[model samples]
Target chain A: MSLAPSERPGTHPDDSNLSATYALVLVVEVIVILGLYWIGRQFG
Target chain B: MQWIDWAIVAVYLFWIVWTGLRMGRKTEELESYFLANRSLPWWAVGLSVMATQLSAITLVGTTGQGYNAGLSFIQFYFGLPLAMIILSLTVVPLFRRANIYTAYEYLERRFDSKTRLFTSLLFLLSRAMATGVVIAAPSVILSVIFGWNLTLTILAFGIPTIFYTMKGGVQAVTWADVKQMVVIVGGLSAAAVALIMGLPDDVTVGAALRTAGAVGKMQALDFTFDTSTTYTFWSGLIGGLFLSMSYFGCDQSQVQRYLTAKSVDEARGSLLMSAFWKIPLQVLVLMVGVLMFVFFLFNQGPILFKNTYLPAVQSSTRAAEYAGLDREYAQAFENRKLAARAMAAAQADGAPAGAASFARSEFVRNDTAVREVRAKATALVKDVTGDPDYNDTNYVFPTFVTEHLPVGLVGLIIAAIFAAAMSTIAAELSSLATSSVIDIYRRHLKPEADDAHYVTVSKWATLFWGLFACFVATFAAEMGSLIEAVNVLGSYFYGSILGVFILALGVKRANGDGAFVGLIAGMSAVWWVDQHTATVYLWLNVVGAVVVTVVGTIVSLLTGGATAGPDAGKSAATRAA
Candidate 1:
């Protein structure tokens, strides 16, 4: 089977796309933590 | 408690059974029975994964946790999204590409049949016992709350699950899960709405949340670096990550869910769905509990939520002491109600920061006073009943449901709890059937059999396991400490299993001898660390995984490391044989 450029091992989008997905998930997590922090400070 | 409520629950059971039976027609072959012919859509498979992981205990217990601990428990899931992402990249593709029936089936190819046999045995033993506890928990809680017989309650939870899973196979389990997910989520949403409506009209939603925040219920993030604490941000993120990895990647119950997906990308999508939604879903569960806490602030609630021994406590010699403590709890609860009102009002009125903070501190003190009285009452109950390790957290949500929810809705939520139990039970029963037949029965007793013959035997295997799990549930409930024993056994095995998988996929040099020995070393280390140190269950997964990898690497190198990949897997297995 012929492989797509991005689908090949050690290639761009697979690596880069996975990295982006990781960044996005982690970033959202940090935002959630910060949101909780703000609620505690504002309301607690 | 009403006739209408009973009808609603009966209808739910009948509906689920009907749906499951309808799906059973597709399971004519072994592949279809276990893996749904590998044609399932990602979304349905994703819901099945979520529903199967959630159990009746978590449904009831988490709300209780929210009522008691607030949002700090959410940190326990901090590593989940990352775990899902990692598994998508690694195991989702690996397991799918290997095209195996059981996760341990790969172990045989990667190492040796003995390794596959050993790992599969570990999965079977731990999972079988754990499934029993899963059935017992809700039944015990329901029996206590509603005056139902425990034996019948166990059957009520178990039999229908067996019927559908035995007849319908994995297709039935997955489709039923899709519907159960709807019921489960709907019930939680209904409870949240009712709790909000239950709050005194004088208290706004904002005020209620702020008051709960004052007592630390709204503090979802605990960024403490303390390794000693259970639900801190670090523990949840790091320890939770390892646990999630092990659970989703290594356990067949979960692996079977994704393995049915139509493509590798579909498999990855299913896991990523969990990655994106698990914490938020947990937040919804925890928020219901927090809302319950808020609802109780203005309302009177039981001092001790679980009242199984309420009669005994009343009739025993300690009755006077229990009554006295009850009175103390009432007074403290009353004071806290007033204090919570003031705190909520102050925040709503935009009181000066100093004044608001003062009101909050008073509220906290009053809450502490109520909890102290509860501890005394709980102690008195333990003395009277001769059952130790008793706590009331599991009872809180069920109690709230029966007392506060409208009659029809109470039945719906009860059915929802049943849905949760059935979803988990169904998945595990099918998985146990799959592993027992494919890994042990077929692989050993009869390596060659028609699909029809195997499917017939697989059905019998499913029935046998269902009955066996029900027996275990009944036995565990009678032997109260056995529940904890099963839990500890699972905690010991989960990480070690994951460690073997990591050694297979990530370490090319690791062979059968190394993987097998590494698994033993990993479990032994976890046991030793658990006994010798104060390391919590979460960190133990990390320890097990790390020790197995390091030990396996050394053992493999000493044994002359791998010749290469899957071929190495086969060669290593042959050499080990």
Candidate 2:
């Protein structure tokens, strides 16, 4: 698997990009959590 | 408890200790003692990470939650995978490259000794107290079931874990955790299967699921944005992310688990493993509780799940009142069971489904009446015992196991509980020792000590903290629910710790004094909100982290930016020290 340019060893993102990463992951997690909520509603 | 069950538990205890001890010979230095020589594979570290987080609270208290409230409590974990990903991209790489024995050691490199010591002490305080509660929870069930005293139960589980952790160090904790995770998963799976099998032959799994759903026990999500509520989807995802970040990123107990990996990528892999498995695992554990709820529908469950309280109420002056309530509860149970069976039959017969819906409503009414009577019985038991805050949610699964499960399976479940408790307690003891010695003893008091001397001191620290945890366990029974108490206790400090770390890692101008005062400010803000507002505890993590970062940044600017130097403390001497 190819590594993201920012994800390679010794190549961390700058402060702005790192902050963006945090926001991006948060949005992704919230979406997945909503998916879990969907599963519970459907199966429950 | 049967002899066969006792024998299974005994063998499990012996096997874990032996496995731990066999790894002890690998520890020849401080690095090896704490990080397993950084030679561990990602999968082993991943399993250990998962096991350490899946404590007795998850096994017992969470299942109790499922039985009491349903799958809604699972929203509390929605932030975990996100937190794991964040940690993988950020702190895991930072800590691995820093070559530190404890996460707080990196704080010193970034800020100052005072900052490191303060955050490290906070971790020691919260984790040490939480460990007591962790060990206390399962011991309550074991003592009640086996007729042993609580102290004896605590020690029986505590001593071996402390011994193995002190002797074998991280290597032992890691491998033991791997096996313990397997045992925990297997044991819970067995109990789930047993519960389904124990249901009347006519009640198929799908029928049981429908029955559970009909009673509102299956609704797992709540999107309503209510700050006062505890387990809504928003609170779980946002607040839970902050909690998970504090726990997996900043807490040494969890951070140390992943730090044993061979490289930064491996460490990240270890956390991602948790991201993938944690929610599914929690779903299964809570499913066991949901299944138990279904099982008890056909069976006659006790008026109070806590049997100790039953005896107390029986012997109290309110015995006649209690006896009356008990009869009512039994009758209600019968009515509820018949209604549930009728609903199942109607659904199977391809009727209009109206009759099934009516029967569901009738069953719910009877179940509600039974619960009201049980509440009165609990109140009476509390008055007689002079113990307020008595809740029996933690006792639900354990009582079902002891009273209902087949003999061999009972032992396996009990053994799994032991594994769950021991895995968490061992990790706490080991991490407590690491921070105490690496962050305090070696860094401050004995900075020039040889590796042999530091290793010996670390072992002694483990024993001291182990004893401290046992003492704390004695008072833990009064706490309402073990899982909530531990998490609430964590929320009190975790946000502030995470805030301090964020300042250390993300903000270039953040100085030690700023980090220090900001942490206190963050904690005080959380305490104020906890006391004065109706905000749920999960949000406290977010509150604390934000308070720390904002307060720390403002304080830093006021104090003349970056007191140590331009690059903070990342000098060759400090980095290589």
Candidate 3:
């Protein structure tokens, strides 16, 4: 029997939501990188 | 060291052994032994995940990095949280649903058997050698500090780990890892606090930061677009993203961590927990090193931290030359310290221009002296050891630990180091055994074997890999940084493995032969890139995964001749074959 999408243990339900989360995470990561760069330029 | 320090270490070791022995009863079955019956709490799994990642090399080498280089190293982990979050939504759930013993097993189901076997073998080869190096890292430091034999130090820490892991399997490994993580964080946090408190009364934490900032030690990021550089923002984001994805997604060592979680949500939650904490935690760890750099500025710091090379230089005929240089270095440091204090006082007195000018000259003089001492030390070491590979950047924290921390705390910290080493060693060995027996032996050689028989063989496999790691640990001293060596080795293969998984998941048309060929091509491409390009090793993941997926898909289209229907039975038979 094919496993239902929701019944499947590890897979999240919505791809769009997952993509949005990923984009959000990428944004945060960029900010962190930029922040570190600013700090390095100022202090280093 | 005091008796209290020994007592703390003794108690910690005793508890570890007890925990391992206690968990032994639950390890009789293969599933329970390998995956803790998939019943672990998120907290335990989370802590275990963090513990496995933070080895003794991190505790010592990273602190040493901070002591010398400042906080730039923290940028290396910026991609980790993003990687973790991405994996949670994709591979974490998929692997849990597949219900496989190893991550490699999923490659067979999704792509082909050869892909699975190739990836599993890569993991074994990398992790086995890496385990030896990991064990040897702390042992080298201990031997240097205590004047003990290296082989004895390896055995002292490695043997107990083997006993528990071979006895209790993943149950012992996960529980021990939880405790080890606690001790490691406690030891590091304690060290940071002590270093801060121990600074000169005249220097506030703010002033120390200002000094470190002034000296360019507080540089935490590099936004330059240089593929050749190891820790730039782009390299960290793109290269680090792929590396983290491949590591957390496909590598069995980490895959096995989440597999033990009670449910998919728990596993994803546990991984997310690591995602959330990884960057900040690394920042804290590296900050300890930066603070130590500040500490050394106010206090009298050693000209050369690794004392092992000092004796060799003294014994050489050029000893007089080295001694003269050392005398000059000491006098230079004295003058620089006086100048630094005067500059600080001048700044306090609102003489900005005078303070700036004095600080500028003092900085140059101090930096010149530091470079001269380093060059002298390196040359002397080369002369004495006859091995040009001796670098003392990795030796900084061990020197600090042995020389600075109080007696009782010293033993606790030492035990924490042992805890970190043993946790990683135990996990790698256990996962190695699981992959070997379940993915290879049980699938091909003994398909009809009973649980009891498989369990017996698994224990034996664990013992075998453990013994092999200890044997390898004897030679690990030749490697410079155990942490860097492990990742470099992983870079050679992790990208290719991640590629196979991507093909299996995203490309439905990709057949077994295509995957098998693509896997080889992927590894070859990565090796070529590594040999030819100036790109950082972390970027190998992106190169390998993308190459394998794109190549594997094209090869599958050419070979399979436009077959569009899902070939589930064909895929299964290919795996069975």
Using TM-score, give the best candidate's number: 1
**Residues B1-577, candidate 3, lDDT per residue (tens digit)?**
5788879988998889789889767776778888998999988899888888888888888888877778877767877888888788778877776667888876655555666777888889999988888888889888988888999999888889988988998989999998888888888888889899988776577656656776677887667888788877678778888888887888788899999999877887788777767777787788889888766666666777777877778888988988887887787777766655654565454666666567756765785676677688677777787867777777777777778888877887888898888888888888999999988899778978777888899999998998898888887775665546666777878888878777766676776777788888988998899889998887888889889988988999899622322223443334333
Please list the residue runs of candidate 1 whose C-alpha ends up more than 4 Å from where it truly belongs after superposition: A1-23, B350-354, B563-577
Candidates 1 onward: DockQ, in order: 0.25, 0.17, 0.32
Candidate 1: the clashing residue pairs are none
- State chain A's TM-score for model 3: 0.58
Place model 3 in a CAPRI quality band: acceptable
Off by over 4 Å in 2: A1-44, B478-487, B565-577
Off by over 4 Å in 3: A1-44, B346-357, B478-487, B561-577
Interface Cα RMSD of candidate 1 = 6.8
Q: What lDDT does candidate 1 reach at residue B124? A: 94
Error of 2 at B123 (Å): 1.1
Q: DockQ score for model 2, please?
A: 0.17
Candidate 1 structure quality by residue, lDDT tens digits, B84-126: 8788777777677667788898776667788899999999999
Write out the backbone clash pairs for model 3: A10-B93, B66-B289
Sort by TM-score, best first: what order? 1, 2, 3
Return the DockQ of model 1.
0.25
If candidate 3 were superposed on the true structure by all CA atoms, what would the RMSD be? 3.4
